[model samples]
Target: KCAQPRRWKAFDGKITEMDTQNSLRGKELLEIYRSINTRGIPKDERTSVLLTLKWTVKEHECKLTQEIVALIDREIDLMSREVKECNLEGLRKRICTLFLQYIKIPEFNPQVAGLIKVPQDPLKLYKNVYFCHSCEKYLAPTEFPIPANSHTIGRCRSCYQLDNEARQREAYFKYRLILENLRKSEVDYQDDSKIVFLVQLPDMQYLIENIWNCQSALSACSDLYDLVMVRWDKQHEWSPWNTILLTKEEADAHLKLCNLQKTYEAPFIYRIEQKHIRAKNYFAQIPVMSSFLHRSSNQSNAN
Candidate 1:
């Protein structure tokens, strides 16, 4: 396949029609390998193609990299969803926390790194890895966060976040509908009468989603609906998850945890505004929120 250019000239020798097609396909696949941390084609002859792919070309690497990242995200999502039945609550949290503390990956690593064999399936090398939080599947334990208590055990963080977000979203919508009904049922009232949207998820998996979707609920709920609290319900059916609710401090903490906390100051200084963001320790308590109470007043004032 590495026929010299001079040889190609004889038959259009290296640059012949068939050669052109082969080169095109090779270049494209090499580009893909670059992003997923791989190079070359399956056969030994093609392995060095990507490494040889010229990098001096402008924008070529970047375009391929973006596509690669997106592809990785899709794969991770599917992987995180397969283990939803695992109810080992404490272990999940510990593993996630530990991972956060120790999992210092460079954001994304090509799965094909260190791979020397041409397996029957390359995707399998990536599957069941990246133990992120969620109900999906995983290929390796390292993909997951290391447990806080142990060195080897891991769980999928993305799955955990997704499940948390879903539950929070449901509660947000349900509470929002109730508030809208209340507003419609009311006659003109004084400022003292306000509606609140309170939601609590039973685990971390659902809380993140609720927070992510809060903007929709905030806009739809009555203007008087100034307060919203969503947390994991500690009730029997959902006792082992994260909670959501209107805690001045804890709520903001969750937002920060989900990376949704807003910029209040020009300098961008921030805090765990939801009043401690309800650390794992607080999971057992009945988080309370009343319309008259405001925990995030400090943050709002700063903003």
Candidate 2:
């Protein structure tokens, strides 16, 4: 039979080669080691590899290294006893955690600098940082959602997620998709539309669910994906007040109408106008939106 390679060369050298070649971190290696059953390996071989790892980690003199070394010694002591494998699992996990910490430090593991999330510059670390009242932690601006009409910062996204899971459970994704489609369509029109850009996600949700009752004005289509909000009078630019909810097919036909008065009955037009008035009443509260509302009303009166 062929002779087996020494445990140090087989395990320790293999780990080092993996770290050098694939840039595998200690945490990743720990996960890989845990996935396999180490019980099949002899105690002497395991101890030999662990000793080699201890010597390699000892090269760095730090508080983290000291903790890792102490845990390794404790693990070796436990292995020498008649304790069950389950009893040693906890100690092994602790050693793995400390070693991961040791490997994360750029001073100990220079290869991890690129992988670390924290910016090295102190100025960059503090820039755009805000405090989340709910979580009581400092986080980046991206971690908090600032609504278009918001005057103050709210809790972080994680806190909002926890709150929503516990309470609201609102699905606003459909409204978001609608708003996105509206913005893209407006951009394609090249009419220099402004109101759609100012309209936020919550506003769209209210417009669909409350003002329009989540149905097409003409066909009463309830499918949100097939529905779109378009200008009631194609001559005027789209705004909350001047918009009508219709299926895509209906919108195409509605936009082609040269005269809304000639194309629709007085009662049908009156009903749509009532919806427009409600939209105006709701959106006019927004200071910026109020200006657009006044301008649209004036333009409609002039026409």
Candidate 3:
């Protein structure tokens, strides 16, 4: 009902409200929303210009619906018997021509594509337009905007905003729990001689070596030794990292694998260290002390 600027005047409560708001100003208000009115023009010319504006205000961006136009004509016919049979078919034909003419007017700048296969029942094409579960409307999909995600294909902008808000709330809760637990947990890193070896991981081997080499300086008399192996496979990889060697000192620390794991876990890193290290291609070794025995680089650490 509140269609145009003049119609909105009814809801304004005061005819001079805009003038009143204009009176209050600041340093910036004096610069913006101020304009000169073109008054005292010829009456005929002014009427013609104002009528064009009214038509412009009434026109929807996607053009008027044919059903509304047909309804108007039928109401006219009921009042004046001079109207012949309502030309439904002719009206549809004329509208179809206009629709096709402006088909490319907006230049196909549409964002959302249809979610469902349209014209599911081809015979009902005349009755149903676009299907929107959010607004519960059967109008054109072009009336709504498209979303970036591929999952919910044809949802309107409002529905998309609602879904994103829900995700933000959920993530906030998830991260809060993580932070709460982190604050409660206590860890000990007092033993420097005991190398807490994290095994079966090559990538982390570099970091473990750096932590021992850079992050801390060990006494020359200390063993500088400790190791642990985590058996990770493609089937059990977890996030933060694909595989986690909870106590792996390095990936290629193959010699100390069993001995360090035994010390950390329970069974024995010492008893099995000699047996496994000498086992087959398990012959890779650390270069720190390649003393009495002779072996290739494959038999020892590169550095």
What is the lDDT of every predicted structure here?
0.36, 0.77, 0.34
Candidate 1 lDDT over residue span 163-209, tens digit each: 78997686666555534543432323223332222323233324333
| Whole-model lDDT, model 1 | 0.36
Runs in model 2 lying further than 4 Å from the true structure: 1-170
Alpha carbon deviation, residue 210, candidate 1 (Å)? 15
| TM-score quality measure for candidate 3 | 0.24
Candidate 3 lDDT tens digits, 120-150 = 4556665546567876766655556755665
Q: After superposition, how far is residue 294 of candidate 1 from its true place, in Å?
A: 19
Residue runs of model 3 more than 4 Å from their true location after superposition: 1-38, 41-128, 143-154, 187-303
lDDT of model 3, residue 2? 10
Q: Quote the positional error of residue 86 for candidate 2 in Å.
A: 26
* Candidates ranked, most accurate by TM-score first: 2, 3, 1
Better of 1 and 2 by lDDT: 2
